[model samples]
Target: MLPLLLVPPALSTAFALAPVRRPFAAAAAGWVVSLPALELPVHTGIGVAAVTAGALAVGPVTTADRVGTGLAALTCGGLAVVLARHRAAARVLDRAFEGFAGSGAVDTTTRTTARNRTPWPTVLLRPWPVRPRSIRARRGLVYGPDPRANRLDLYTPRDGGRPRGVLIHIHGGHFRAGGPSRESRAMLFDHALRGWASVSTTYHLSPTPEAGFPQHLVDIKRLIYWIRTEGPRHGIGADAPIVVAGSSAGAHIAMMTALTAGDPRFQPGFEEADTSLAGAIGLYGYYGRLGAETKDISDPVRHPADGAPPVAVIHGTDDMYTPVKGSRRLERHLRAGSSNPVFYAELPGAQHGFDAVQSPRYLAVVAAIARFTEPLAG
Candidate 1:
């Protein structure tokens, strides 16, 4: 019984330490393990009490069993310490930016009547775990001559009205394998519900003839230029705000593009067009690429300055794949140099790709996203 009890937690402690290797371990570590860790205070206390109760209830065991119970008890204590780190991170986030959620108010006392009002299912978690069903989406519209690598999707509100904003979501798979249809599960309809159009674009994946460093970014540039120039004809344009966002690899691209602001290298033919972004968002992302190696390279933080657009970044403290330290370093760099506002959230027990689905943590981060992006729209 003691070994059985230890197996579940001992496995998690190891995975949390070691980067995920197996597909099963990836899913469990990416999603399942963080759930309890997010609510670590509650789980840790309950676990210790439960273990004590179980040991007292089932007495008269062999000496080996007793030793096993003691080891299990020690492991449980370590697990609690691990979970406590999550709680500490959450406190750091709250202290850093608590009242700013969707209100922009620094403290509760500064909130106005409008800020006090919260939108249903927008800033708050849905009672159900599922995302709102998508409506009125246009799929696989060709944006460029490259038939295979230049397609994009637009999800619009079913009700015919001009969108309040547009979100361009770039999928992440180390620039090799992800597609528009592969990611942005929770944001698609949620943006539509809030009267915003959602754009998910596919770039030429790596290992292909057309896919290269700035070329992949150029495909995204074509999407941005298309939206800014041609979006109004389809009822999405300068009237509302436009935010470019992405996860991991996509986040890297989003940051680089937004920071460059139509640099000629990334936008070869269409260099004069206004490719400026209203805002930028990156989830569990970093400044540069190549896994913690940086220099005067093709990265965003290398070119920080005043007048850069506002950015909201979310990173998980427990994320070993990308490491949360990168996000923290970028935040410090941005704050020290950039004149624009930098909203950063470091979740306590979250892992890489944590927001693949709707959870308490995901919804809360979405609420922060709403707050950050709302002010961008003129």
Candidate 2:
């Protein structure tokens, strides 16, 4: 988990200083952590795996234990000092701008306002590409009443033909920050253009500090049931294959849903429900036991007794947040099961959130998905 601890701070710094630098920093951090340690290979491996998965799932750097918290505090304090110093420099720059204005060369208020309005240099430098009409026109939504949770967005092809397949996407924000609206638009567009309808939904987050685990999974199962029952009306037929794709916390949810397919524990509301998913796509998700010998971290929500799903695992080689090994291990476990297809891809120099978002790496992932789903669509 050391990687998880490191990622947030590193990402925050990269965002503050230069957004363009984030991918590079994240990649570098992932590589640095991948090297084998000199002694205690097993322990190092476990720690590295945990840290990497945590980083990918949570973001940035992670630590193994509580002592890392103290170090993190110190790091935060140092950053605060640096930020104060930068503010002082900004004041000097403001004064210089005033001097130039005094010479009757520029309108001070307008110039200052413009400067203030300008987004961070990082955001400006790495502007996302404009999507084509084939991609952009596919966005749509589906809503249901959940007094406790947010509504869902269902993105599909604008063309009136029946969809070839469906992908239910789950967004990630540690199960606290993000919502369906923040789900990757690129994935939705790619799937839509590839003759697949993509359903992205919101779940209840950890509104209180004490909330965690089962609640998130419960919300996801409800969404899954809704999709299975309601998708036919939306041109996504019940017989059409359905895949669950999620990143970070969403990845966890997708895995849980796949594992619990057809299990009575997860079945409710829908009669004759065959929850067997066509496949599952987990992007830098948290896997492995929270404690030693605990493979199923989600107890009642995701039990080992539940059959596993056909899975496609995509992760960055240098992902300090979620180690690539977790995907490797998951593939191993799934392979040992009854002939489930498990495809694993490790991207060089990529990091967490590489596949879903608008990065160059994300585009490549979209292409890969398009290629993978082509035969199924046919």
Candidate 3:
């Protein structure tokens, strides 16, 4: 009972209420509060076992307590079913972009079994890899005037190269507390190993410095221009393809930028510069607006038009932060509105930020990304 109180029941209750906003320190627990809800089989098994043993030792609680226990049990069963379905995410990827490589090209048919295979059932629930070998990052290049706020980190293969494709990653913390070098390091390193350059960037957070509107977008646009002008010193050519990728709030920004490429309102001085992206990838993003529709670009789904770049969207069906329903909406709009293809994959039982580390499921998504952006390579 005590274990159950601390885990599924407690976390699930918080998730139901949905209170992970603002003055972030007070809301910090909501961050990790989501993990157990998605990976409930293990937590539920232990919790149920502990409760049963304790019940045998010290019998009978109130009717209300019994009712609570029954509800928790039901929750466990539902979570288990959802967890079982999560394995189908790879198939979702396969179906979404059947012609990713070329027309009539088949991908991962031989690798399908291997892609979803894991050494154990609880492999993903275990700790993730911290340091991947032969990956190097150059940290803290002063791209903007504010040193602490306007720095970026660049990652490349240990041997390195002037790769034709570059992935620019944006970190997510509700537009509050996260730096460029956090969360998606594993994804960046894996891209680097595949002979692609990866960038993790920092931009201004919202609602503290100013309202969460034009400032954040402006800073990102500035970074895009900087890379276009100065990318060659590190080997990204002027014509090289750029794919913008982000998770959570960062995903919203990535999708919005891809939808509204180079509107003068977002890019002040560099209004005329080439701010086009080869592709856009969103991981568990919400396309809601911050301010009044100051520009025509209010939300990605609302503003999506024809001729946008191809997009890859990955979301967890179990995600509560940015609901899977929202990703579904974005996917439908992109498919209907954009001239290029929109590939969407939904992991069944995974929660938000599931790919922050290295695991079989995540690496599979990384492979999907490799395929999605393959057409964009210059």
Candidate 4:
């Protein structure tokens, strides 16, 4: 019975550690467990519960039960240490900015706010993060030809002041599926409350004949074009400095947009439009090509042009899908050419989609982004 009790934690730990390559269902399960694993404190509590169950077991507590309890205690202690590190995420992110040119000091205290203070009830129950009411949002504004995929949601502070900066956040679903409404609500709301105009936009997913390499990029470019042209009517200045951010596949698009600014290939109809960016932020991004049909031009690292803007690449060391080495390679390539700061934070024990929730780890990331990009804004 004791060994049977250890089965759940042991399996979850295995799933978190193992690399899922085949069997789509197995990969899906891994992704699901990875989310809870990132909540170290919550996971540690489970271990504690397992130990308490062992202590209360009736009828001749076996040696197996005692061993299971011991193992549960050890897991609890290990997770406690990881939780401390997660709490100190701001400092850890700062260390990553060291030695990068134009990298300024990050004030961790002021960046942390009441918004990041997760209530015990919410944290224990693990609900999806909801957009703050303090943020004024305009949802489902069309940006391109496609009515559905071309729509964008713009967010701003409810104080009714025009935001001088704009942040465009793209969603990540392997370039196949993901919507702007679900992911990154916490970060978007935090930025909006801080007086920046935040825009979350949808794009054409991949594998379809209509959507692929430059086509997806073309849609993003169209969104940028819309921001420059139609944004002034919505309180965003036409010349406001814009920063691009994305997760997973969206990160790849963000990096490409940053590096390939003013390239006619990406902006076929709007070649004359100004698409330059102030900076870029990527969360657990994939740098390589997506499919066999996709060309080398889709590779972000391949097009490290001169005058590249400041970049922030944050990834989890324990990510099962996209490895951390890709981010490391991207940092090296960017640092070699670009004179701007290249902040690369490799979070310990974090999993993919860690930023989807408002965990302590992601709160630190949000603060780091504020420190990194706020200076670039006017």
lDDT of 2 at 53: 49
Model number with the top lDDT: 4
lDDT of 2 at 270: 50
Please give the lDDT score at residue 109 for candidate 4. 40
lDDT scores in order: 0.67, 0.56, 0.70, 0.77
Highest TM-score: which candidate? Answer: 4
lDDT of 4 by residue, 87-141 (tens): 6665667667555434353333443344345355644555457777888889999
- RMSD versus native structure for model 2: 19.0
* lDDT per residue (tens digit) for residues 1-378 in model 1: 666665565555545544363565565554455344333323443564577567657867766567656766665666666555543443444455653555542233333333333344532344233434545778898888798889888888778788988898988877888788556556655677778888888888887322457777788888888888788877886546778998888887788777778678778889997778888888888566443333454667787645467887888876665678888877887788876778788887677776664444565566556656766655
Which residue pairs clash within candidate 3?
none
Query: CA shift at 75, candidate 3, in angstroms?
Result: 11
Error of 1 at 261 (Å): 0.3
Report the alpha-carbon TM-score of model 1 versus the true structure.
0.72
Model 3, span 1-378: residue lDDT tens: 444453555555445234464445534456566555444444554565566456645756756456556766665665555445545666777666665546522243346566556434434454354545677778897666677777899887677667768888888888887888686776777677777788899888865322667677777778788888888887778777888999888888888788778789888878997888888989888776654644345567778558578888898765656778888888888878887877888876566777665444565677677777666766
- Model 1 is weakest, by summed lDDT over 10 consecutive residues, at 105-114
Clashes of each: 0, 25, 0, 0
TM-score of candidate 3 on Cα atoms, chains taken together: 0.77
State how far residue 4 of model 4 sits from its true place (Å). 5.3
Q: Residue 358 error for model 2, in Å? A: 3.7
**lDDT tens readout by residue for model 2, 1-378:** 453555545444333222233465764453343322211122333443455445446654434544455444443553443334322322333343353344332234344433433233322233243444653332344333565464666666667677888787888876777876465566766687777877777777885312645556656666666666887777777678778888877887788778777655545555356777777878777665433343354631335523765566676654565677777776666666635545566655454565433433454455445434444442
